[model samples]
Target: MAKKYVDINTLKYLLYDVYQLEEVLNQDRCEDHDISSMNLILDSVKDFSDRELYPYLKEMDEQPAHYKDGGVEVHKQVGVMMKQGGEMGFISGPFDYEEGGLQLPMMLYTASSFIQEAANNHLTGYIGLTLGAAELIINFGSQELKDIYVPKMLSGDWGGTMCLTEPQAGSSLSDITTKAIPQSDGSYKISGQKIFISGGDHQYADNIVHLVLARIEGAPAGTKGISLFVVPKKRPDEEGNLVSNDVTTVADFQKMGQRGYCTTHLGFGDAGECQGFLVGEANKGLKYMFLMMNGARIAVGRGGAAIATAAYHASLEYAKERPQGRKLASTGKKDPEEGQTFIINHPDVRRMLLFQKTVSEGSLGLVLLASKYYDLKHTLTDEKEKEKYGLLLELIIPMVKTYPSEMGAQSVSNGLQVLGGYGFCTDFILQQYHRDIRIFSIYEGTTGIQSQDLLGRKLLLENGKALQLLTEEIKQTINSALKYDDLKKYAGKLGDKLQEASKVIQHLIGFAKKGDYERFLSDATPFMEYLSTITLSWIWLEMAVNAKNALVTGKKTYSEEFYESKIHAMKFYFKYELPKTNGLAEVLLNEEVLTIAGEKEVFN
Candidate 1:
């Protein structure tokens, strides 16, 4: 089978036609960019990823980062690739030109990242965190801090990590015990341990910058007292020479996948010498970190979509090339000479492939849509427009983060199944893709955490205005799609889903109003699952309508099969995936809370 990254045609259609990215580019913030330049940037990244990253993906996975001689040793290729990415300016693709960036629109950057991540996620992740780290400094750091740290990080001369997870504290960051003491020179001495810090300790860069959250002495307890700090692995001395800052690597974690990058247990101020500079205000660390977290969460979603896309294409290639059992339609035939039929001709294999297609592409569209909202939220001058887009982004962030992650895992599994026994073997990358994407749902925030955010907070924020705004957006899509003969059915189905979801949410709100908050959120996970399905349904309908319009109006530049495939996948999603919401809604509407409400003795 041929090696693949992603379907370029579908991406072009989504960006240029469905999403109308050209319109976005015309906006003041993105007016400087156009399709041609964005395409060139994307092509460059793809070419580099194909040549440098894809070939070394297996090597990186096989050669996991190791703890040797008091330092982490990753595949040497990782350093080379990081430098390659840095030189290509991908590390600062969305930043301003003055910052040595291309200032590409986020939509274009998301698409570019999709291709690169599809080619090799483990390697791409090394720089992904660096971009986020740099963005934090740009958004909230002092001018000096930004001037010093952001440039090197953007250049990939220095690596970056978000240090939040500790030995005792995982997702509940309020429990973090990392301490930062004020020093005489306007710096703080950071002392604590952080675990699962990816790319934490490596020789890929000249230095590593850690965006750590620590508490100052005499501060209040919990997350309210946490402060953000920029702690570098090596700090400059009085002569401006980089020296060891007392940051130590206690250990490296061995994971099931993404072995190319290092996840380290780091100890700060073991020698009582580690120093850090505060970012933004003290005790506002969580607030500042969340700025990075939201973007990282969406990036995780894109990662999930990218890996799933690679799996789908690989399996699709395998199915077409690898001859297997006869199609079920040929059951009564006795043509022995005909031999085995291609597995793609079989309905079951097609089902699996379509599922992968709908999940991967639909999730990709959802993420890009959220990114558009993010752009408008930041760049729009009108306060009302910014506020509207802000609420829209807040509501969809969890879905855009978790839906692709959880569903992409399932899609990859289906892709693996499509390849039969060969997928489990090392001859193919399916198993690796499967392994790497498992961390998508687990990291960023678990599906459970996202579900709670979606239900407990997003739904109730501003007295339910966020949810109303989201529904209105969905309604607009429905209204636009309702007139299309080919899309009306899916549009109507999506409308029903919105109504059903609204009712379930209202029912949950009733419990909350009565102060039964725990019970109100008891089935939040399932509710999130249902909402994700509806959101994707809306996306599929929107895409189908766009495809239908292109084909009917002769506006499509691709072959007929290209447009048909979009509609086919949309139908597959509506017929097979969207209906699952009914059962989820049923569970949400029911009052029986067996998991949390039942007696503990019942389990035994």
Candidate 2:
């Protein structure tokens, strides 16, 4: 078992030092929480993860979940995870205390989630999906619906999922053909097929509740007519007896990685007996589902970052323990008297490790920033304050989802490279991590989807007010960076990049203004890459400034080495990662527009 996957210190540092999560806790919505209580929550989660999760990661992966006898079977520990997680309020942490929750901040829940995700990525989703589904119920479900489903779902006796994608429609939700017919008793008969439903069917839970999206009969076409339904594998009869709901587990998807997570093909109302209860009102299903999207996307990114963290640590451990080469002298001659040096001592290995460090830890910072924004947006009383944080959150949601996913893949790949041949073999964890992380970019939304949302929608959010707020925020960080002599040059470099960003955005917006959306959105993925790179640079700089302040202020909360490592990583990110934005901007600015459909086809 890989013992060290995530660094808890990094999570705390981002939450307390860089972001000052206490600011949110002091707000009216979360005033009950404090730093000490939150720390204990994190500490307890980490301890639970160490005992129940970390040890079985490999075992779960080796014994992949399988489908047989009308249900999907997974590693038995999945039950333990859901049950214990609920008992400890991990699922209900972010909900209101009146709703039987601990009412913890989302960032703290995010921190707890990262620890478990790093410990066992495949198994953690069962709990995550349950949390997402349960939250949706708490927010939108009718009182009776809540009375029947909320308690069991949150208690871990019943798992929950958002059934969105279908085999025919995939990411295109408008094309889904699922149908829900209204019945006399305020229930609907749902008939549809949903594919790639994670935690779709599991034997451990007594029942699974699916928040399914289906169109009511005689409603308008496309997403406008869609409605959200609370569909369960087993429903209570008029006498309150549990009976099968005819929600069939069609098959299990055997994937190259994350094998323990049971992704299934589902057939609803196969025998025309599936009953579903409406959530909120009809035709607002898409909106209700979208309300949960930002949080879900952030969780997906966190999963990617956590996997990369685990993979990096696994590779780092291998590099430190498996020494094979001798160190060369300044004259480029091997020292015969000096024995073989650990690969970690080699500059190239260290470079790869540092790259992983910058990507994983920095990605963590970005996600927490998004979550903090979420906290403030919902918690703040002033309308202007809420609007500001909400827009900022809107502007960065795409990057928050894409950067960790798209870059975390590269980070995990580097981790594999660090392990050399062992990285490719099943004997090491990197190979599985390499496979596990490939799906993140595709999850929640693909990178292309995120990029388009960024360029077409998010960039223009609230008539560009969001981007302006982002610029102002970045400028604040730059101003802080300017205070230190060592960081002044990097700060200036960032200022130039911000100007360049303005120029590039103007150049693209000009295309959009002229009704050339084809060209405007052609290089969106590259723009996403560019903007995500710049965003991470901003975060690293902020972290560096905080670390420097700690050291200079004589606040020895962490050791000098701890603070210095972030400083070094910040510098490393600026040198290595930020420069790529220039090339991406070049691609975004070029008017040639090769990728858009042209007069003639280029590919065979």
Candidate 3:
């Protein structure tokens, strides 16, 4: 199989034609960039991935990251990606010029990241966590703290990780017991154990900085008491010398997949000497950490998208070349005497390939759409436009973070199936793709957590105005798609989904209105899948209409095959994938209360 991890043409189409990257580039924040400049960076990153990422993926996975000599030893490529990524501005692309960044649009940076992830997801985490942690410090840390931490992180001389999960708390962050005792010098003595910390402790960088969530001494209970801290593995001394802050790598967690990305159990203040500096105001830590979590959520979705894409191309290449069986005729007759035919000639194989394409491409589009909203939320000049974009971003975050993750995982599984038994074998990368993507749905937030968040909070955000804004946007797409005769049915189908979603939401809201919040959110997961299906349908329809218009106007950026392919995938999604909502909605509207804990024990 070819080393075709990502389709640059498809990425370009989504960014340039579908999402309109120029609209973002025209903004004051990105005025210095255009498509040509963006393409140059994309090409560079692709080349770098080819050289530094793809070939080494299996080797790293086989070797894996392990604890050695009190530090985690990752593949040497980890160091290469960090230094080269920092030199190429991958770590600081979206920061301002003065912040030692390229000052580029987030959309472009994310697109490049998709390529890197598809090539080697395990390696991508090293730099991604650094960038996210540094961004938190830049946004919320004091000037002195920023001066101390952000530059080194961005330069790849240091690494960063967010310490949130504990052995007992799991996802219930409110129950975290990490403590921060204030000192006379304004620094705090931090003590806690954070498990499942990715890129937590590695020998690839000189030092590691942790953005920790801890509670101050004598503060309120629960989330209200939490505060953010910049706790480094080695806090700097008065003469800028690096010394131990008593942060210890207690153990590295071995995983079933993403073998090269180290997840460690960290113990802070074992010697009662862990120094932590406060970030922003006290008790607003959750709020600030959420800012990075949202970004990490989208990144996780992109990880899913990238893995699915790589698997699709791998399976596709195999299908086109690997000959095994003969295809049946239109009359449903097969001749055993005939020579073997390529799997691509078989309808079933084509079906599997199309499913992979549909989920992978659509996932990329959904994530890019969210990134566009993010760029607009920050860059737009008008307050109203910024606010509108912000609301839209908030509303679709659950879907943007989840559809690609959950659906993309299923898509990769199907890709594995396409290769028959070889997909699960080490001869192919499909098995690794499957393992690497399984974590996204569980990372940042689980699918259930994201679902409950969407149906419970975002729908009611801003007095329900956030959902209203999304409705208007979807309707606008439907209205534009109505111009083409071929798209009318899809347009109508999408409009019906909107109505179905509205009805389902209203029915769920009734339970909320009656003060039965448990019943209101009982079916939140199904409702989330329902809403995500509708959103993906809307996304596909919008892209198909763009392709149709391009073909009609003869203003093709890609080949006619590409445009026609979009139309075919749109039809496939409508015919095969969209109807899934009917079953999900059925589950949502049945009013069955079997899920919530009841007065009597149900399960045996």
- The numbered model that scores best in lDDT is 3
Candidate 3 lDDT, 1-604, residue by residue in tens:
3558899999999999999999999998888888899999999999999999998988988999998888898999999988988888889888998878888887998899999999989999999999999999999999999999999999999999999999999999999999999999999999999999999988889999999999999889999999999999999999999999999999998998999999999999999999999999999999999987668888988999999999899999989889997878767898899899999988888999999999999999999999999999999989999999999999999998899899999999999999999998987888988898899999888999999999999989999999999999889999989999989999999999888888888999999999999999988888888999889998999899899999999999899999999999999999999999999888888966888887999889
Two-way lDDT contest, 1 vs 2, winner: 2
lDDT of 1 at 209: 93
What alpha-carbon RMSD in Å does predicted model 1 have with respect to the real structure?
Answer: 1.5
Error of 1 at 227 (Å): 0.1
The 0-to-1 C-alpha lDDT of every candidate, in the order given, reads: 0.87, 0.91, 0.92
Q: Write the per-residue lDDT of candidate 2 for residues 1-604, one digit (tens) a residue.
A: 4669888888899999999999989998788788999988889988998999988888888999999998899999999988998899878788888777877888888889999999999888998898889888889998888889888888888999999999889999988899999999889999999999999998889989999999999888999998999999999888988899989999999998899999999999999999999999899899999999999999998898899889888888888898888988989999888889999999999999999999999899999999999999988999999999999999999999999999999999999999899888889889889999999999888999999999999999888999999999999999999999999988998999999999999999998999989888888899999999999999999999999899899896788999999999999999889999888888878878677777899999
- Candidate 2, clashing residue pairs? none
Task: Give TM per candidate.
Answer: 0.97, 0.99, 0.99
Query: Where is model 3 more than 4 Å wrong at Cα?
Result: none
Cα lDDT tens digits for candidate 1, 1-604: 2378698888878888888788678778787888888888877878888888778888888888989888899988778767877888778988987766777777888888888888888887789889988888888998888888888888888988899999998989999999999988899988999999998988888899999999998789999999999999998777978999999999999999999878999999999999999999999999998976767877888999998888889988998898877654446754666689888988888899999999999988998888788777877788998898899889999999999899999999999898889889988888888999999898888999999999999888888888889888889988988878878888888888887787888899999899998998889899999999998988888888887877889987898888888889989999999999989988888877787855466754
Pairwise lDDT winner, candidates 2 and 3: 3
